[model samples]
Target: MAKALPEFAPLSLKELRSLWKKYRGNEDIERLVLEVQFSRGVINEVDDYFKIIHRTWRQENLGELIAIEKLRLVLVKQHLRQTVLAEIKPAPKGTKPSEPPEPEPALVD
Candidate 1:
């Protein structure tokens, strides 16, 4: 019998953006995000999942639980990107609001 594939649910765009804001400065979180985004299959294996979290924390010299939380945020962002893209609507022609673009982070420093 073929193994049943696990269902994967991506996070909402809002949630992903929030997580990015919260953890953008952490190198461990950055690494974890890359891993989760590129990993094959649904991430349903607990041991493998935790191992990634553990490795990231140890390599980055972060506290254990905090590292796990950061890794979770990465996963959330990956999921969000996948699921949220479909829901985003293009701005209507001429009717779109003309808000100023977000300022570059470097300009704020």
Candidate 2:
């Protein structure tokens, strides 16, 4: 871990998107990394509650990490597929969700 992100529950989509856009250098591996972190965090937090996992705290292969990485590709693929298939609803009447930000007035020549 180069730098750790703050511990966040029900992770914020806005923060994740910001991280994904700026911090995630490799778009190809973005989802894979997120899925792994999410999966591993869940397992660790659960074990933390039980207090019976990773006694030595070694960085060797753990079952959860292995399983998450193994399934990551498929999960990412599914996520992408679902997003692509999602419906696009226009902003409600009188609402401005779809509107672009108004441009600044042109400077005088």
Candidate 3:
């Protein structure tokens, strides 16, 4: 039987821009964005997007990067699927201990 591929909901343009802002200085995320640009043959569009961001200091230019091209959007969503899920996943809900655990007593021979 063929292995089932995981399904990821498509990310909206807004979400992609938000991700760019949230992880702006992360090298890994920046690399992923470049990979998506190359993989989708949208290098020029992505470059122009970066220029706009550089000029205005606005992260929302990331949205414009994929907005003009549907294929770019699809490629970006696929590349960033894992990152998006990780960022938006809820934190585990549990109470913390009131006090730190005491260090184990030192063993003496």
Candidate 4:
């Protein structure tokens, strides 16, 4: 019988962002990347937060770059919507998620 696969917890925002950035290149497309993540439901946040950032706090900034960066950050954070989520627990206790499965031996004649 095959060994049961171990489970893995979802990556945290900080971890996810770091991972995604490590894999993804070109900072220019940050907005687009964030938008995709937001739509994926990977980010689940309430509208009130967005209203506060985009509507209230956002008014404080008017510079082009700051405005753009802030917009993207707010969007990403809002979508992430994780206020008090549990930290992704370490790999199921002793299980190693990185280990590869053994290949089946060739059938004998």
Candidate 5:
């Protein structure tokens, strides 16, 4: 029989953002290089830009970018909702609960 894998918690917003930044930052750096090349007239043709960017200039990239952005918005909304709920239902004050009074002794026969 296969062993069961341990359950893992979902990634927090901070973790997700860190991961996104680590990946997207590299892509952004590459894109900036391309942008500079274009500005300096180093890349004259669309084909050259595509070749340098290591992509075939497909519209799929734009669609994926939009989808990822939309997912980010949803994550933000959920986080905000959870925050509001937590604030709205704050925990009870830190007071020691009083003990119940001792039961009265049974009446003598």
Candidate 6:
């Protein structure tokens, strides 16, 4: 007999909804929102944060650039995860139904 693979439990819609609501009103939420709106092309927040840290490091020599880089990587990953979750969560109850899906692309002759 073949062994069974481990079962994976996906998060409930309610839990995802709650998580989405918890972060929606936060000022930091705006960063993720901007990222999604811009289709991940913009990096203003990340660039600004790095610039400030770089300036501080230059003046104080308090930490190495590698340390700052590590921190920035962690923050960027977190922002991406939150943005994806927010996008996936369903809209609130009583809202109008969403529009129909976009038409499929046509093949070129």
Candidate 5 accuracy as TM-score: 0.22
- The candidate with the higher TM-score, 3 or 5, is 3
- lDDT against true structure, model 6: 0.48
Error of 3 at 102 (Å): 63
Best by TM-score: 3
In the predicted model 5, the residue pairs found to clash are: none
Write candidate 3's Cα lDDT for 17-75 as tens digits: 56667788898986765454344334334434544444453445544434445644654
- Number of colliding residue pairs in model 5: 0
Listed in order, each prediction's TM-score against the native is 0.27, 0.23, 0.30, 0.24, 0.22, 0.29
The model with the greater TM-score, 2 or 5, is: 2
Question: How much lDDT does candidate 3 score?
Answer: 0.46
User: Which portions of model 2 miss their true places by more than 4 Å?
Assistant: 1-28, 52-109
lDDT of 4 by residue, 1-109 (tens): 9998685443454665664566566565555546544543432333323444555445776434576456667655543444334242222334322342232221111
Give candidate 4's error at residue 79 in angstroms. 10
Enumerate residue pairs that collide in model 3.
none
Candidate 5 wrong stretches, greater than 4 Å: 1-64, 88-109
**Among all windows of ten consecutive residues in candidate 2, which has the lowest summed lDDT?**
100-109
Please give the lDDT score at residue 60 for candidate 1.
92
Score each candidate by Cα lDDT.
Answer: 0.48, 0.42, 0.46, 0.45, 0.38, 0.48
Clashing residue pairs in candidate 2 (N, C-alpha, C atoms within 3 angstroms):
none
Candidates in order: C-alpha RMSD to true structure: 18.3, 18.9, 18.6, 19.4, 27.8, 17.1
Q: What TM-score, to 2 decimals, does candidate 6 have?
A: 0.29
